[model samples]
Target: MTVALMWEARAVPGRAAELLAWTEERARELTERPLRRETFRAPQDRVLVITWWDAPYDADLPELPEPADDLTARPVHRWRFESLGSV
Candidate 1:
């Protein structure tokens, strides 16, 4: 089975760059490597990261942690999805 983890966050005001940098740094420092990883950004200072792992849906996997309070507008959002076969 394959699992895809999604982590999204919104930066505080003008701190989007700093928050994105922090997220990238933390993702790189993870001890376990994922099958695939990607980062994205959107309007309203939102950032999203998706990591794919070759493990069961409930398997333990390293995930990006929350940035400092001043860096984010609110708590981070995360989700997990089991991958279906690609078309």
Candidate 2:
């Protein structure tokens, strides 16, 4: 089954640009190509990265590490989902 990894972070006030740059760097660290991936940002400094892979949900894969505490308002959040069916 294909799996989707969602990694999210919220930067400290006015640090969204820094957080986005940091996550962009992490995306380049992938060991293999994903089926598709996307990154999004919200007005409140929230950043989200979603990467789809051609592997099982539990498959070992590279993941983003926690960013500097000073750059984030809180710890990062991650979740995995398996594709059910396409619309």
* Candidate closest to the true structure, highest TM-score: 1
**Candidate 1 lDDT by residue in tens digits, 1-87:** 989999999999889899899999999999999999999999999999999999999998999988999999999999999999788
Residue 83 of model 1 has an lDDT of 95
Clashing pairs in 2: none
TM-score between candidate 2 and the true structure: 0.94
Candidate 1: 10-residue stretch with minimal lDDT = 59-68
lDDT of 2 at 71: 99
Q: Which candidate's lDDT is highest?
A: 1
lDDT of 2: 0.92
TM-score of each: 0.97, 0.94
Over 4 Å off in model 2, which ranges? none
